[model samples]
Target: MEEKLIELVADVLEAEPGALSLDTEFKTDEFDWDSMKGYAILVTLEDEFGASITVDDFIAAKRVGDLLGLVSE
Candidate 1:
């Protein structure tokens, strides 16, 4: 899930996968991340992990690990 989420972050933010890590703050670490990117990640996460995520949940996420935690929950 970590690897897949890293790849999705890169795809949505147009970043290099190598630039991200398990602890990467997906929202703040990247200059280009926006609400739209958050939305994209929400949908992709649902598709990939079968997790039900809300806007508030996505907005509450501060890091990539938050996402992993969310889906795992």
Candidate 2:
């Protein structure tokens, strides 16, 4: 799941596949993860994991690990 998460995030952000890690912070220029991208991420997560994510969930997430937690839940 982590591998898939990494791949999806990297693809969405147009980042190198090997560049991001679990501890990678989303609130940075390196990730280029603005709110619009964040919404895209939520959409991807719902489609990928068949899970519903809320705006609160998106707002509370500060890192890739938090996204993992969201999907896992």
Candidate 3:
């Protein structure tokens, strides 16, 4: 699941899977995560994992690891 999530995120970020990790912080200097990217990720999560992620849940995800919970739940 983690590997798949990483790959999904990397695809959204236009990055390589190897470039991302659970510890990777979104909207940081390393990652130019904007509102568009956030929404993209949210939509992708719902589509890929069949998980319902709320706005609050998305906002709370500061790192890649944080998103794991949204789907796992």
Candidate 4:
């Protein structure tokens, strides 16, 4: 499950499949992550994992693993 979440984050971030680690920060401006990408990630996660995540979840998520934890729960 964590692997899938990592894959999703990598895909959305346009990074290497293995580049996203559990402790990867999602809010770094250096990564160029924006609201549109964040929304896309939320939609993709819900569609792929059948989890009802909201924008608030994205806002609350500080790292890739944080979102994964929410899905796991």
Candidate 5:
């Protein structure tokens, strides 16, 4: 599950899959994540995980790990 989540985030962020860690910040300076990419991520996660995530979830998610935790719940 963690591996799949990491791949999804890395694909969306255009980063090397191996470069992403659970602690990586989605909106940090090192990553170029923007609002558009963020929404894309939300949609992708919902579709892939069969989960319904609200806009508030995206708004509150500060990192890929945050989203992972949300969907896992």
Candidate 6:
């Protein structure tokens, strides 16, 4: 799930798969993470994992690991 999530995020953010880690912070200048990208990620996650991610949940996820937890939950 971690690897898949990383790849999903990378794809959504147009980043290299090797660039993301669980601890990596989102919305940083390192990645082209903006509101649109965030929404895309959330929608993708919901589609991929069958999890309902709220906007508040996405905003609360400060890092990749947090997103992992949300989906896993």
The whole-model lDDT of each prediction reads 0.81, 0.85, 0.90, 0.83, 0.83, 0.89
Model 6: clashing residue pairs?
A: none
Which candidate would rank higher by TM-score, 3 or 5?
3
| lDDT score, candidate 5 | 0.83
Pairs with backbone N, CA or C atoms under 3 Å apart (clashes), candidate 5 = none
lDDT by residue (tens digit), candidate 4, 5-42: 88988888888867779899977875688888888888
Against the hidden reference, what TM-scores do the models get?
A: 0.86, 0.91, 0.93, 0.89, 0.88, 0.94
Candidate 3 per-residue lDDT, tens place, 1-73, comes to: 9999999999998899998999988667566768998899999999999999999988978999999999999
- Please write out the lDDT profile of model 2 over residues 11-64, one tens digit for every residue: 888888788888888668887658788878889988999988888988988888
Task: Report how far residue 26 has shifted in candidate 2, in Å.
Answer: 1.6
- Estimate the Cα RMSD of every predicted model relative to the unseen true structure: 1.5, 1.0, 0.9, 1.2, 1.2, 0.8
| Model 5 segments more than 4 A misplaced | none
Give the worst 10-residue stretch by lDDT in candidate 2.
Answer: 26-35
Candidate 3: lDDT over CA atoms? 0.90
lDDT tens per residue, model 1, 2-39: 89888987788788899888788888644477778788
Give the true-structure RMSD of model 2: 1.0
Highest lDDT among the candidates is held by which one? 3
Q: Which stretches of model 2 miss by more than 4 angstroms?
A: none
Better of 1 and 5 by lDDT: 5
Instruction: Give a tens-digit lDDT track for model 6, residues 1-73.
Output: 9999999998998889898899989788788567889889999999999998888888989888899988988
